[model samples]
Target: MTILITGSTGLVGSRLLQRLLEAGYDCRAMVRGGRPKPAGAHAVEGDLFDTESLARAVEGVTAIIHLAAVFRTGDEALIWKSNFDGARNLMAAASAHAPHARFILASTSNVYDKSQARPGCESDAVAPTQAYPASKVAAERALCESGLTWTVVRFPFVYGDGDGHLEELPAHLLSANWHPAMRMSTIHHRDIATAMVLALDGKFDGHVVNIADDVPASMLDLIALSRGEMTASARPLAEPWAMQVDTALARSLGFRPTIRTVFHAAEQQLL
Candidate 1:
């Protein structure tokens, strides 16, 4: 079966593309910015904003792994356009061309309500406060309502593979009104890729799945990882269990993470 991967040049998508090829699946990589195509995969040059290119990207593919999104942009308009409108455009194309194709969307655990007293779950209410998470929520809703086989994999903070995304935590903590005692749910890039593959083949059609590591990382751990030193904060988490997501559903669906914790990241010197 052939699979089309959008954002194939990104951190998570790039790795997933390699893994999919290694698994002996025919792959089509939707690429832009003159990014070099994977050796064994066909490259379809496209932009999410370009409907024609999106149509070209989805032709004859049995599955579409959509990982392209705008998460760290300062422009609010760009965030909605890239996340919501992008998913809409792709779904429209897939509906017309590859109606029966499996569509797996990459969503975030941040879409969960942050004020709840317990860990986030698939059935929990969502209240996104920021543009990125809000856009993802909108995208998720669109895909769920679209007339196609779909699965939404909600990921927590994905790190590793030389990703410096967490490295900015030190500055963010200093500048933003973030609570130091707040814990973070995390998953390695390998695990996220595995989840995507699982979602592609698993019996989770028309459902949402949460993918995360076994344990939650404290803000102190993140600060120490980002910076060379660690410091304590007297402020406690808004709710004791906030940001700790429940992965029981994903685990039951046969997703066992090879890297169970951020400590593994330290072992590989990825932090």
Candidate 2:
């Protein structure tokens, strides 16, 4: 089975591509802007904005792992175009050129409602005001409506394998003024591959699955773990469950994370 991966140079996508290639999977990378192709994988030169290129990328692959997205940017227009419009374009190309290919979308847990009273579940109605998550939600709905076999893996704070995502968390949360006590679910890079392999096997077919590790950590502890300092506070949190997620569905579908927690990553020096 040939798997086509978009965003092969991004944080999650690059790492995932490496893992899949190491395991000897037939892989193709959708490259754009004349970027160099990855080693040991076929590079299908394409752009998400260009449908013709997308068609070429989706031509005969058995599956499409779409990790391309715009996040952590101030540009709203770019975010919407890349996240929503681009996704629809790719879906259209897949439907027209590769109707039987499994389409796996990498969504974020940030799409969950900010005021969620419990761990964000697959059934929760999300209304993200931020452009990034809002655009992801739109893309997700469009793909579900499209006549294609699809699965959405909503990821939490993804870190591990020296990705530096966790290292930058303190500055981000500080800028957003996150509560010190606010807790969030997290997933290791290895576990993301685990979820994707499960999706490729039809374990999460036609569903939105939450992929997170066993425990949730607080912003205060996370800041310390990242070695960034912030003033401590004990104020009550208005959205205590904002970033926490329910992984029961993923577990039921047979996803057991090899790294159980961020603390485990710390212990293994995987941060």
User: RMSD of model 2, in Å?
Assistant: 1.2
Candidate 2, residues 1-271: lDDT per residue as tens digits?
A: 8999999988999899999999888999998966988888898899988988898899989999999999879999999999999999999999999999999999999998878879999998888999999999999999999989999999999998888888898768746989989888999999999999999989999999999989998888888999998778877889989899999999999999999888888998888
Clashing pairs in 2: none
Q: Judge candidate 1 at residue 105 and give its lDDT.
A: 93
Judging by TM-score against the true structure, name the best candidate.
2
Show where candidate 1 strays beyond 4 Å.
33-35, 268-271
lDDT of each: 0.85, 0.92
Q: 94 in model 2: Cα distance from truth in Å?
A: 0.6
Reference-based TM-score of each model: 0.93, 0.97
**Deviating ranges (above 4 Å) for candidate 2:** none
**Top candidate, metric lDDT:** 2
- State the lDDT of candidate 1 residue by residue for 172-229, as single tens digits: 7656556667788999888887787788785667789998888899877877877634
Clashes of 1: 0
